[model samples]
Target: MSVYTTVSRDSLQQWLQGYALGQLIDFQGIAAGITNTNYFVTTTHGRYVLTLFETLRLDELPYYLSLMSHLARHGVACPAPIADHSDRFASLLAGKPACLVSCLTGTDVSHPTAAQCRAVGEMLAQMHKAGATFPRKMHNPRGPHWWSLTAQQLYPQLPTDIAETLAEEIHFQDGHRFDHLPSGVIHADLFRDNVLLDGDSISGFIDFYYACNDILLYDIAIAVNDWARRDDGELDDELARAFLAGYQSERPLSQAERDCWPVMLRAAALRFWVSRLQDLYQPISGELTYTKDPAAFRQLLLAHRCRSEFWLG
Candidate 1:
């Protein structure tokens, strides 16, 4: 129940009148990611997801809604935002921005197999390809600027070793520039829970709220960091290889992408490390909030720092 705004059945039913969707059959608060309030919205028409944006404003939502529409139209397995009768993807609900999206099949895998990793990689590559044609662009709010700002805020609260690592990693990342890399729209937060699987096939890539323009390789790195991660927070070799193999099968990585592989990996790790720290130390009160352990990504970042060459080589 990461529900910040509770919607009663009567209010929700009233909202459904705006959409062509039949009467709201049932709806329940979803306990998934902490960023927004979600509900499993089932109507006489179909099963869909209802999201109430906790932080993002109404006008700031078109890019994401439009992007999802674009990706879905291009055959990407993701939620497609449902436009209301007025052809608007978003409207105010419970005094917050809200939208509905077609729900896809399948549950998220906790421990993905090599095949699932490969499927996820292939899906990501497809998303990247489709995103190339997406006209509009939005800044990655959780990009480097966010990393530095969050690190500064967490420094005083962090343990000695963690703080030192954060400082060193931030300094290291500041020196590297990704301006020359292939840039495109990316699903910046493609954690395991964000991807859904139906049997052996990928049903959808959900939670596109973190989507933005960035180095294409960084998106792959984000996916690999989560999909190919082992229990000890180290890269699982076989799974990593399968993932990259699947991605390259769709779109071969440019030499520049390969050359900067390690950087992206470490950068990806550091990003999550800082975010997890924020979630742990400054958690917001919610009906049901799920915060991950910050130490997992912290350990992974350290391991990545120790690597001299790409392990996948």
Candidate 2:
């Protein structure tokens, strides 16, 4: 979460008056993510997070807010959006679409242990099951179609080999249809930074802006790619196995999902690679932002291409 919009103390206090959150004691900008303006807000009532939408529209926010509420109610560990005096989840802060959510209790662990990976895996599977009955039907915005378009957009700016690799992968993914696989609302960007941990147990999952309806295996692949990776960008077999085990403890994977795991791994890699490339080439300025390296995901994609069998084993 990055800060694109700045809210003044007086203005923030005035806004806080609209809610029963007591007076705003302190707030600070969060600079770890690339999407949305986020701040750690503290009040006499409790701690919370204030987020201003940087790219999401006002009309398109209900799905995310409602989904979070649904998952939280269903025993998923996630931040629940707080409504205002008018009982509205979305509001305007610094003239941008904004909302507040309860501040999660833990901190993010970058280099997680095997047990931590298991916790995240279990939580993710529970999230998918809880969201299965959610009424919203938003598609994955960074799925294959977006990957194709983004690859084309970035091709001219990249080296020949990188561009060719991206184009080829896009073509291959387009030809492969895993639509029949188990589909549900997925935390599409369940990277290390998006999950919070309280001493090896998952405290909460944050940053649901990228959440959408997608293949369940694809979501697992995304998490595994991030949480079950070694320093060299290769999958850590023990961690991966533990994570899969935890997920299966909740909802077992189908034979079809198993067959498509390798491709789904590559698909997840390609999605992040394209998005990082886009951010690298076409960046939006924010008050506080963190732009990740595109080459990291490029290396990850190549590693997945070469070592597809490693994960399945």
Candidate 3:
């Protein structure tokens, strides 16, 4: 139900003329994501995905498109952007910025195994490695500044308990600025739905919309927050450890990263807590949009606050 802006066959066929892709056979709306409108497109030649931007502006699109292309070329399994006749991957489509990308295989896992978590960790590390060489840079848009600003907007309407919890966490994060840790391009959002598994290995990582330059550990924390979370909102130690093991296999963490582990974990939790709360309160009007439950992240944030430090071995 994520198709916000509908596209008819005729308009899509005309748009396809800008590329070398053959005649369109069929297209179906993908009902998985929450941010943008996505469709699985089939042509005589091959299958692809068409994403119509909902909130992102055209000027800020090149960084994401280029990052995906950069990652794909460097042996990272990600959707490669398809360049049109003019060597452009993005264009105005149905009055919105749109682009077509190579569609990948595999289903989003519900209950991920330690092995699967390991694979995701490996891919994320690989992405970070590849992203380091990318000349362009975009700082994390939802970093601490966003957490504070968004919290201010939420306080007036939020319950006192939630507001107090958010304020305390934000203040705590302000004390530690992880500037010295490893910095590079990070997929700020790496939840289960953003990953697809084929057998024991990962088919690929999808959704690079939130990719940006930041402390590498933050990316790991974000992934662990979602991928390693359990039914009752507690972390699965086995899975989280497996994920960290897989990542370390590719790129080892520094002592500084280890020291800041708990802070990074709580930073990741508070970020999503504020976001999910915003989505719950000031929801955007979309014909097909999915709003996740804020309760899980809230519970997770509370759980994280109880732990003072995290051990990385």
lDDT of 1 by residue, 77-139 (tens): 999999999999999988899999998889999899999998999999999999999999998
Per-residue lDDT of 281-312 in model 2, one digit per residue for the tens? 87756523456787877787877777745444
Tens-place lDDT digits, model 3, residues 1-313: 7888999999999999999999999999998877899999999989999999988888889999999999999989889999999899899899999999999989999789999998998888998888889999897879899989999988999989888888888899999999989999998999998998897788888899888899999999999999888887888888898899889999988889998888899899888888889888878665334577888887887888786435355
Runs off by more than 4 Å, candidate 2 = 282-289, 308-313
Please tell me which predicted candidate would have the highest lDDT against the true structure. Answer: 1
Candidate 1 TM-score, C-alpha based: 0.92
lDDT of each: 0.89, 0.86, 0.89
Error of 3 at 232 (Å): 1.1
Off by over 4 Å in 3: 284-289, 308-311
Model 2's lDDT to the true fold? 0.86
Residue 82 in model 2: lDDT: 90
Output the number of the TM-score-best candidate.
3
Kindly report the root-mean-square deviation of model 3 from the true structure over all alpha carbons: 1.8
